[model samples]
Target: MFKNIKNDLPASVVVFFVALPLCLGIALASGAPLFSGLIAGIIGGIVVGGLSGSKIGVSGPAAGLAAIVLTAIGALGGFENFLVAVVLGGIIQLIFGFLKAGIIGYYFPSSVIKGMLTGIGIIIILKQIPHFFGYDPDPEGDWAFFQVDGENTFSEILNTVNNISPGATLVAVMGLSILLLWDKVLSKKGKIFQLIQGPLVAVAVGIIFFVLTQNSSYLSISSDHLVSVPIPEDTASFFGQFSLPNFAAITNPDVWVTAFTIALVASLETLLCVEATDKLDPEKNVTPTNRELLAQGTGNIISGLIGGLPITQVIVRSSANIQSGGKSKLSTIFHGFLLLVSVILIPKLLNMIPLSVLAAILFIVGYKLAKPALFVQMYKLGWKQFVPFAVTVFGIIFTDLLVGICLGLVVGVFIILLKSYQNSHFLHMEDVSNGKHKIKMTLAEEVTFFNKGAILKELDSLPRDTYLEINLLKTRYLDPDIIEILDNFSVKAKERNIDIQLLSKRGVIENPSSFTEFFRTRPKSKLSLS
Candidate 1:
């Protein structure tokens, strides 16, 4: 993990800046004390990153859980009660990992996964638009279409025009220009540029701009436009930010329900992020999904005990890490440490860094993920692949993360079924034999229950007095549902004066007695079905 410290060091700094406002914003959205979000972010980074098998993936307080956390805190009684659910949720995730449920991530279609990445990218861009102009009406973690502030995403953008802050807009523009110049030109010139990341430069400039413009009424950036980390005056007050969970709530049935919900959602989100980060990795390193669950479980347990929001592997932070050149887990851990130390030591200084500057940084991250070229590329792959990708992107933008992915998966499954129906069997007309039509129907390899409808329709449509040859020469692992259909069709053939024949590597059988029994009793064959 330390082998790439030079890369990981700068990457970690960039991720830290990217994650700071998000951690605080997510806490604000969840109605939890702002410090709790920082706790989760810290644990997710240092603890989870240390334990995780992923090379470049990062974890923290996730925006997707903001609604659930808000509702859960109210429904479960209080923040302390919610903590019990979080701890229980961690235990449940641990059990899920042990059960090897990580394989669930593998079941998602490639199109859906790509859609998720692109959708999130679009969201990051849209959500940050208002903040980019210094209109901080809603917290950054509000991923839903409808906002708690009584506006939808697009409406919020419309509102930004009336509320734009001149100082923030100017600083944001300068920060963005620095990022573009550093990325497109400066970074290529020397190792010093790589060592000192563009985001850090932008952040420093934003702070300096905020400090210098404070007296200019029209051009000055206010505290409302800056990052807000809880400022602790002394040692005792610093420790007071931590809230311990009320373990007594563990007996509540409502707590259990919340626990299960958190576990299920957090696990699903983590798994999806693992898949996405692996795709984003330059080396294409695969993270062990089961290990990731265990790591996340541990992070949640620790985070909950210390009064934190539920934890999950988040794609935005992970993608930022990858885009910033994080080559290993060290970047993740370092960012966590940075959060811990910065909040404790320099929170006031942090608060001076304008949100618009961070918004500028995220704009770049968002564009990279949702690049226009990706749209044309997906379209070129045809509707079978493009439909799911488009649906996922739009769904995420319209609904939320989980809902969007579910929509994409449904579309992907429908396409799979359609493909299966069309490919179940190959039918051809052979030469007529003895005044009867000779029909040759070849079964496809690995026919499943999904193909049952197509196979049944073909069998029932056979003409009377037809000579049917059911060829299994390319068949392997045929479903019993399909076998039953074939067996029933054979019995019906007698009344129609139709003759039946079965052909396979085992040899041809005239009028097979029982298709179900035949497939069930057949010995395993080493012979090539292809």
Candidate 2:
């Protein structure tokens, strides 16, 4: 983990900066105590990072689960009750890891996965727009098109435009300009630029801007424009912030429901993070999914034991970690340590950071994820891939994340079935010999009940007064359901004045009246009609 300390340290710092505001923002969004997010971040970075098999994936309290957390907290009666669920969720995740459920992540199509990344990227960009203008309504965790506070995303942007704070806007613009300049122009110019990371530079400039505007009453900027880290004046007061969960409510059935919710959402979010982090790795390191599940489970358990929220491998921070040149898990671990130390020791320093400046950094992140090029590329892959991809993108943009994915998955399955039906042997046209139109219907490798509709359609559509040839040469396994379909088609074909030719290993037979009965007890063979 420490093999690349030189590169990793800088990366850790960048991730640290990116993670700080997110930790606080997610906590605020969850309606949990503000420190809960930081606790999760610390645990995710230190505990999960130390245990994770992933070299580049960064873990934290996820914005994706903010809705669940919010609802769970209210449903369970308090934040403490929710913590019980979080602990149970960790236990469930551990079992999932042991069961190897994490392998499900491997089954997603590359196109769909890419679409997910692109979709998230677009969401990040859209979400950060308000933040860039110093307008924070639902905090940093709410990224959906419709916010929990009943405001449309686009409308919120319009509202933010009308209420833009001049000081925050100026700092944000300057911060963004510095970040872009450092990344696009300076970073490539020389060693000096490489040494000073863009996000770090942007954040430092934001802090200085806040400090300079401090005493100026005439300045439009106020303390609210800066980062709001909770200040603990002394060592005694520092430890007083942690809130212990009420363990008496642990036996409630509602706790279990909340646990399941967290487990499923956190696992899904973690799987996405794993996939995304893998893509972001310049060296292309593959994180073991099962191990990652275990790591996340452990993180959650530890976090819940303390006063923290449930945790997952969050892509936002992971992507930032990679983009900033994080080379190892150590970078992730150090970032967590930084969060712990900063909040306790140097919160005043952290508080000087402007929320708008942080928003600017995330805006860049969101833009990269959902660039227009992603759509064009997906479309070029053909409709089979493009249709599902497009559906997912639109669904996510219009609705919530899970709903959009379900819609896309449903459409994807329909397309697959359609393709299967189109390729079914029943639809293939064959040539005729002599006066007999030899319609050769080569059964599929595996014909099942789902192919019934296509089989019936083809048989009913057979031209009248034509000889139809049906070949079961390539068929390895034909389900009983499909056999019934063939039997029905044969009867219909005869009535339509069509001749049916049957070919099998036994020999060639012309329109056997009892074709279905003949194959009823047919023994399975690798080369059935070879």
Name the top lDDT candidate: 1
Give Cα distance to truth, residue 320, candidate 2, Å. 1.1
Report lDDT (Cα) of residue 403, candidate 2.
70
TM-score of 1: 0.97
Q: Evaluate model 2: give its lDDT.
A: 0.81
lDDT, candidate 1, at 316: 92
Q: 62 in model 2: Cα distance from truth in Å?
A: 1.1
Worst 10 residues of 1 by lDDT: 521-530
When superposed on Cα atoms, how far off is each prediction in RMSD? Answer: 2.3, 2.5
Expressed as tens digits, the lDDT of each residue in 37-68 for candidate 1 is: 99999999999999999988989999999999
Q: Report the lDDT tens digits of candidate 2 across residue range 271-337.
A: 8668767976889999999999999888898888777988988878888888888889989999989
Error at 112, model 1, angstroms: 0.5
